[model samples]
Target chain A: MVSFTAGDAVARRPAKPGRLSRFFFAGNGAGYMFLAPWLIGFLGLTLGPALASLYLSFTDYDLLQSPRFVGMDNYVRMATGDAKFAAAMKVTFIYVILSVPLKLIFALALAMAFNRGIKGLPFYRAVFYLPSLLGGSVAIAVLWRQLFAADGLVNSVLSVFGIDGPSWISNPNYSLYTLVVLSVWQFGSPMIIFLAGLRQIPQDMYEAANMDGASKARQFFRITLPLLTPVIFFNFVIQTIDAFKAFTPSFIISAGTGGPINSTLFYTLYLYQEAFGFFRMGYASALAWVLVLIIAVFTAFSFLTARYWVHYDE
Target chain B: MNDAAHAAPPGDTPERPILHSVLIHSALIGVSFLMLYPLLWMVSGSVRPADDMFGGQTSLIPSQVTLQAYKTGWFGLQVSFGTFFLNSLAISVLATIGNVMAASVTAFAFSRLEFFGKSFWFALMLGTLMLPYHVTLIPQYVLFLKMDWVNTWLPLVVPKYFAVDAFFIFLMVQFFRGLPRELDEAAMMDGCSAWRIYWKIVLPLSLPVLATAAIFSFIWTWEDFFGPLIYLGDIHSYTVQIGLRSLIDSSGTSDWGALFAMSVLSLIPIFLIFLFFQRLLIEGIATTGMKR
Candidate 1:
């Protein structure tokens, strides 16, 4: 059993000045105590796996057998020998580059359109935002596959216009485009961010511009565009990271094949195949490390460049 | 124009402009149709008789509707979706409870308490936010497998207790930071323990943000398929998403109607939650974005 002193409650009072000097030490110790779980997860789970992968990048450790340290073997294989990895890289880059910019443009445009005083604005915003919430799920990816199939809804609609649609998810050449369309369709989250940014723009500026006979286009370019750049930069960094980490759609749509001759094999999907499918844990670990480095490099580069472009109100 | 602006607000009249109202309504209606089309198609496709599912044109309305698909889907497969919904609900609720309690407690410490390694630990927490789950998935799975947690809700629920989600913590911290420190100082002057202040003061005032977190967590967990798919291999343990996927994979003849019905049903909880918490969610999201 526990016993409490009469002054246990009184002990809650603010520490004395002499003792307060030790507050940082006391607080730091308590803070670390509070952070213990996350720190343990980081050091034990994240750090261990991360370092293992980096080391394994130099080895050939298929899951069943012991990993043999073959320095630079996997890197060499990737750099010079592996053609499919290169193909996967190309497909992923194209998807990211095309989808990211288009998504931003669409989201920003729609946000601007909806930012005007409109009735039932919430309903409209919710409608546009729904697709993004559903975007990354297996069900949505399955829905994408069904919608783009030869005898599916898209083709059925196309048939009315006397034009036949290609097998969207099946055709290697067209499959990537379908995925790009899928990415654009789920532009809701970015649109929400843009909407939030739009709301922050003071109405007085626009009114002043209107009084000065500034065209809507000119007003957008001079005021709205410059002011919204920070939000845009924020969205760009997040979307780019998300796009690079894309997995669910390709996994579900391809039925784990990544096929139609390996068209939709995303980086993370390929990493899964290596680790889980081929039992190449060591190589997969190496790939994982490479991905980390790539993400870090891209993120660092973005931050380095952000100084020139991103504007802060304060 | 200057005289009119001085006399009364511009665009203020005895009544709202009929033309503007019409234009707004029309635009909203048009966008609503676009937003709801795929979902509508999914519903219609799920209910239509097998022969009429792909009958001809992409009609928004179904030619023939039947509940036979739902009937067959429920009992046809060795697995049933009723059980799957139960699985999803149980996991979602447990995860939500764990997340709210653990996240709020930790957020309290980070926000209100003066402690050592506060900034360093907070930075570490934020750093975890940027680390993609893909990097951790294999190891996490391997860890679970070794612990014999596979095919159990343990894998799904345990992380919630540990405050694995930095986003929620960050959000709650921001919410708690907005609260006045005067409350804590006054409570201290009156000899109130930190825990008491957190319980009596912070928890009560933090309801709005907590509600926001709860709503998002429930929806996210409900819709989550990947974690359940990877961890729970047993058919009996399948969540709705996994159940639907398995149905599609196992059925000799695809039952589009039943799949669509289940999909519609699956979206219900999220929509209902949104309807109930719409204002809170809107304000929460708006404020969080603005604060950032």
Candidate 2:
């Protein structure tokens, strides 16, 4: 590390009496000073709040009343009695399952297309990436609502073909699908990562495959895909975590309702409702901890599974 | 200028080149439309009258254009577009500055310095990248709330000084690592301190990557709705996205034209930043990746 090297360098240089030692100490002091605000923030803001939330989760803290130690009552109630929580879980799981795969495919497909020595590459890259940059914001969520409402642009477009389209955002059963589509549309970030990975694949491999009379499709599947696995795995892990924690769109589109029938209610959205909306901070803390556990388990599972499929070159 | 341009095709049909060019252009054009359509529609809808904004009667050009929506949205602090823009700008600019300066120092330490636990510390930083931001949200929120800092910009900009975002650190580290060590070594031989070397020599050479980090942090923090939404309760402190969300009253009937107009305006700053810094980002990525 820089700190140790600088210390040694100071000790070795015998210039002024204790000047080098003083400089070394000064550097360390400066580094710590620079880190002070964040350290304070972490200890006071982050760590303290985390502990409070954990303690509160085991109590009956309704914001107004002094928290009574209820000892896992919130957990038991959520796990056993809360059907809405169950529905939210189901919706979020379905969303993660549906969105993650489709988003990966879309990103991968676009990345591959762009990788094929396209002209105006930067222009295309910027254009495609703009959506992801805008995706999770309230503005985009509102746009999604308008784009999917019965009298909205999508349905109206369908009307031109004499095919009536359903109200995608308003229909309880179909509402979640609108969110899924939104997820798929914001494929830019993963696509950029994929593009970077694709460039790392040796061009010589393709040349050799071509020499062996391999078709483009065969080369892509045999060479491009296998080499791209590590990046795919990375994207998968990040995107899955992101989709599970998705909140803004559902919150905005549903108008903080989590309905037409709680179909569009994501896990984070529900947790937020419990914490802020309903003032059930204790229950929300439990829900937050559950989410962390779920994500950890899923991430660990993927990392474990990566050995079978993810092809790390080195 | 280059040998590839003049190199003749080996045993290829004359028509192959022309056909390939055609195919590539056609595909590019098709893909371009797919990327541009939604944005084009959004822009056009902002100008179009409500009746002409939707339907089986969609046109590439609006039948009637109006500036009334823009006038109403921009000047009307009733919804507070001006305040929100300033809020987003302040948060994003401060966050970007913190990210650039702090990330550069941390990355310089990791890449160039040979201190104790260097690898361990580096790995620790990388490990933090794997931990989802969601895991830290509850704790971070509580921390700020306890300090009575929840409704302020402190929560948004302050933690960035700690190099909390390992991605930016990783990015800058890669850039710093790619720089020739001879510069620092030569400076050291001339009795230059490490801080002086970083400030004068390395930092100057790292403008490209720093620009990349700055632009990225600006765009990401600018568009971050969640942080502003949770931390800032007062309407005056709402960022553009949150402020836009507030426009939709409980009745569910929002002024569509005004919303879209504000959306278009909100996008301008990001778009301009992207246009300015994009070349630097592309060049930095290409050179840095190729270095090792």
Candidate 3:
């Protein structure tokens, strides 16, 4: 009902004598004026840095000296010689794959439970969402480390049942899993999103299915899951992206080493270590680009495959 | 919206059995406890005496509650935790102000004013939303290092003033677009400049979204570890996040009680924000589908 394009604004203006007058009278000046800050940021911070990083990726640049142009050397090294690079990729993929779906599933389940007209919905929602709000904090990561320690709360809980739990944070095999659990623990945001999506499903659809004697579980599969696929896709993409960029937990948990045999070596952590820890700025830039490529490919691949699964209300 | 419609309708009649209701409530309660367990444990651990801090104790209630850990943790490091809190508070406040102001200004342009290449810039902004920060991390660091902005709060705070966070801009734009055009048209007919309209009409009417942006900006800035860790080398300039990390690194689990106490102290601000602003935070996430 309200269309306010540049053309519409121009049409609302009085007839002008010349191009110069039209340019002066138009909204362009005011628009650009308002956009100045964002524009400066986009150029100077985002786009400029992106391109510079791309260029820097080709060279061998430590922070202490000028970059040497060694085209494709970094890529070749990553592909052929670097075991840690491979390990980091393996660890990151495992993290992203395991954490994203697990988190989303937990989110969706809790969201569904919350949507069932519970008595204290807001309180429950707030309580659940608190962890997510705090999940990215250094405190939570610190808490996570302590929780998974050998004599930590998790093992303490296990010991009560006459079972000894492994030292999760220090053990390479279990350390990544601890991070994954930490991730799944903060499923509140996606749960909120899923709850919002669930509310949008028409009640009539369920009503119609019920009249046909469809079971509740059947109704969920036939009606709810299909209709909720778009939200699922959205959450999938977003959670996957966020999981890929996850740093604080691993950084804090690993004590910034990504060690205990580099088992918890997240890609971002690896990139951070290379750039800052080792001063391998050029190699870090290369790692950064590789990460961007991985994400882009994954996103594009998801979108390409989305038509097979994601349903829209056409 | 009747109560029946709001209830679980597809599975049964409007009135459910007492057993089902009890089951659901208990399930929810159990899960909620499980969810809050770690946080609660940390709080308990913080108050516990140093000797009782560890050794397979998962009790929510401490054997003996003491403020000694708080005292020790507050002054444990070279720079007091209080200084880190002040540093974090300063950065978060400045960053929040810059983010909300710049984002609202930019959103006004995108939503209300029309300019050449508007679509192009809008698309670019959206693209940045998905672009990995890693891609820009090295170069931005180099850029800041070159400009001698690394050690100061400039690297952490100034980009916010320039509206580098495209997510906030996008969020505000979505909020601004929903605002009725009639008000803008009326103001324009009254010969009000675009700035006057934005500052007077739109911003005043956009308090909820403005508040959302401000709250999120502050929380995110406060919670941010990477930025401060990378840029702020001086311990005195460290944010709460960096300070917490430094606690672990310096003490190396020798003072778990102090560590737990400092951790609890660090979370207090966020917990307070959540307590006071739960509605705004929830609605903001639900409406925009933005991650916290």
My TM-score estimates for the predictions, one after another, are: 0.90, 0.87, 0.95
Top of the candidates by lDDT: 3
* Runs of candidate 1 exceeding 4 Å displacement: A1-18, A21-30, B1-28, B289-292
Model 2 over residues B122-155: C-alpha lDDT tens digits? Answer: 6766766655465566656655776899889999
- Assess the local accuracy of residue B180 in candidate 2 as a C-alpha lDDT between 0 and 100: 93
Q: Write the per-residue lDDT of candidate 1 for residues A69-147, one digit (tens) a residue.
A: 9998887787788877887788888989999999999889878877876667787877777777666655677677778
Q: Evaluate residue A245 in candidate 2 and report its C-alpha lDDT on the 0 to 100 scale.
A: 81
Candidate 2 regions off by >4 Å? Answer: A1-52, A63-67, B1-24, B75-79, B114-121, B280-292
Task: Encode model 3's per-residue lDDT on A1-314: one tens digit a residue.
Answer: 24667767677664644555665557889999999999999999999999999999999999888999999999999999999999999999999989999999999988888776778998899888999999999888988888888888888999989999999989988999999999999899999999999999998888888678888799889988998999999999999999999999999998998988999999999999999999998999999999899999999999999999999887
Number of the top-ranking candidate, with DockQ as the measure: 3
State the C-alpha lDDT per candidate: 0.77, 0.77, 0.90
TM-score of structure candidate 1: 0.90
- Measured by TM-score, the strongest candidate is 3
The candidates, ranked best first by TM-score, are 3, 1, 2
